[model samples]
Target chain A: MLAESLALSAVLFVIGVVGVLIRRNAIIIFMCVELMLNAVNLTFVAFSRVYGATGQVFVVFVMTVAAAEAAVGLAIIIAIFRHRQTVNLQNINLMKG
Target chain B: MQPYYSLYYTFPFYLFGVIAIASALAFVTRKSPVTAALWLVNTMFSLSVLFVLLDAQFIGVMQVLVYAGAIMVVFLFVIMLLNLGHPSEIADQRGRWPTLVAAAIGILMIAEIMVIARGKVASRFQVPPDFAAEQMQQYGAIGTVARPLFNEYLLAFELTSVLLLVAIAGAVVLGRRKDTRAG
Candidate 1:
C-alpha cells in the first residue's frame, strides 16, 4: 500500500517535471514547480507512516519553504513582466549567453 | 477471504490518488492561467484528503488552508496582475523537441519507480504492525507532530520564519513601482 502511494507520488513528480520542461509560460512553470514540491511532500508523509512523525515535521518545513519560494518567484515574474511586457520564456532573454 | 474491511479502508486512498493525478494533469494542460490555478486547487484538496488518509490530520488541514487557500490566492493575484488574456497565443510555442524530451524523461522516471516498487527497495521501510494505531492513541495526531516541530526541529522552525520575512521584503522591493512619471 505504501509502495502504491510512493509510486503515485513519483508519477506526479514526473508530470510536474515534464510540465516545467515543456511549458513556456513563466507562471505555468512556477505552478509546475509547486506541483513537484507537493509530490515530494506526499512522499515525506507516506514515509512518515513508517518512520513516525519526523517525516511529517519535515513536510511542514517543505511547505514553509514552498510558500516563500512562491512569494519571491511571483514577484520576480511580475518584475520581469513589467520590464519586458511578456512572460514568454523565449522573449525574456536579456541574460542569454 | 482477504479481509473485506481492508478493502473498504484502502479505497479512499486510491480514489484520492486518482483525483490528485487527474487534477494535476488538468492543471498543467490548461491554456488559461486562471483555469490552471483552479485545477491546481483541486489537486491540493485531493492531496489534503490523502494526507488525512495517511493519519496526518493536522498536515491535511494545513494543506488546505495554506496551499489551496493562501498560496493559490497569491497565484491568482499575480495572474490577474499580469493581465494575460488569450493564453492560446502564447501557449507551447517551443516546437516539438521540448515535448519529446519531456515525454522521454517522464517515461524513464515511471520505469525507475516501478523497478523500485517491485524490488527490495520498498521493503526496507515497512511499518510495524499496529504502530500507527498505537502512536495515535499515545500522542494523538496533532500532539505527535507538534512535539517534534517544537522540540527537535525547533531551530529549523524559527529559520523558516526568518526565510518568510526575507521573501516578503524582497517581494515588496522587487514589485514596487520605480517611477510614476511615465503613466
Candidate 2:
C-alpha cells in the first residue's frame, strides 16, 4: 500500500511537471506547482502511516508554505498581467535581458 | 481469498488515485484558465480523500479547506480580475518538441519508481499496523499534529506565519494600482 501511494504520488508529480513544462499560461503553471506540492504532501502522509505522526506534522508545514507560495505567486502573476496586458509566457520578454 | 481481500480494501485508494490523476490531466489540458482551476479543485478534493484514507484526518481537512477553498478561490479571482475569460485563452501546448520531452520525462519517472519498488506493489496498501491509530487515540486527530507543531516544530510554525505575513505585504505592494504610484 505504501508503495502504491508513493507510486500514485510520483505519477501525479510527473503530471504536474509535464503541465508546467508544456503550459503557456502562468496561472496554470502555478496550479501545476501546487499539484506537485500536494503530491509531496501525499508522499509524506503515506510515510507517516508507516513511520509515525512526524510525517503528518511535516504535511502541515508543507501546507503553510504552499499557501504562502500561492499568495505571492498569484500576486506576481496579477502584476505581470497588469504590466504586459497578457499572461502568456511567450509574450513576456522582460526577463530575457 | 487473501489477495481478493487486499484488493477490495485497496479499491477506494485506487479509485481516488484515478480521480486525482484524471482531474489533474483535465486541469492541464483545458484552454480556459477558469476551467483548469476548477478541475484542479476536483483534483484537490480527490487527494483529500486519499489523505483521509491514509489516516491523516487533520491534514485531509486542511487539504480541502486550504488548497481547494482559499487557494483556488484566489486563483479564480485573479483569472476573473484580469478578464482572462475569453481573450487570453491561449493554446495549452507550445509545440511538438516540448510535448515529446515531457512525455519522456514522465515515463522515466514512473519507470524509476517501478524498478526501485519492484515486487512490492502486491503488498502495498495497508499502513504499518497501528502507527497513526495509536497517535490518534492519544492526542486526537488535530492534537497529534498540534503537539509537534507547537513543540519541536514551534519555531518553524511561527516562521510560517511570518512568511505568510510577508507574502500578504508583498501582494499588497505589487497589486496596488500603478496609476496611484508616482514612480
Using DockQ as the measure, the top candidate is 1
| Candidate 1 chain B weakest ten by summed lDDT | B1-10
Report, to 2 decimal places, the DockQ of model 1: 0.75
> Clashing residue pairs in candidate 2, if any?
A1-B124, A1-B125, A2-B124
Error of 2 at A53 (Å): 0.9
Which ten contiguous residues of candidate 2 chain B have the minimum total lDDT?
Answer: B1-10
lDDT of 2 at B30: 89
Worst 10 residues of 2 chain A by lDDT: A46-55
State the displacement of the C-alpha of residue A67, model 2, in Å, after optimal TM-score superposition: 1.0
- Candidate 1 lDDT score relative to the true structure: 0.87
Candidate 2 lDDT, tens digit per residue, A9-97?
Answer: 98889899999989888888999999999999999998887667889988888888888889888888888988989889989899789
Candidate 1: residue pairs that collide:
none
Error of 2 at B125 (Å): 20
Task: List DockQ for all candidates.
Answer: 0.75, 0.73
Docking class of predicted structure 1: medium
How far does residue A57 in candidate 1 sit from its true spot (Å)?
Answer: 0.4
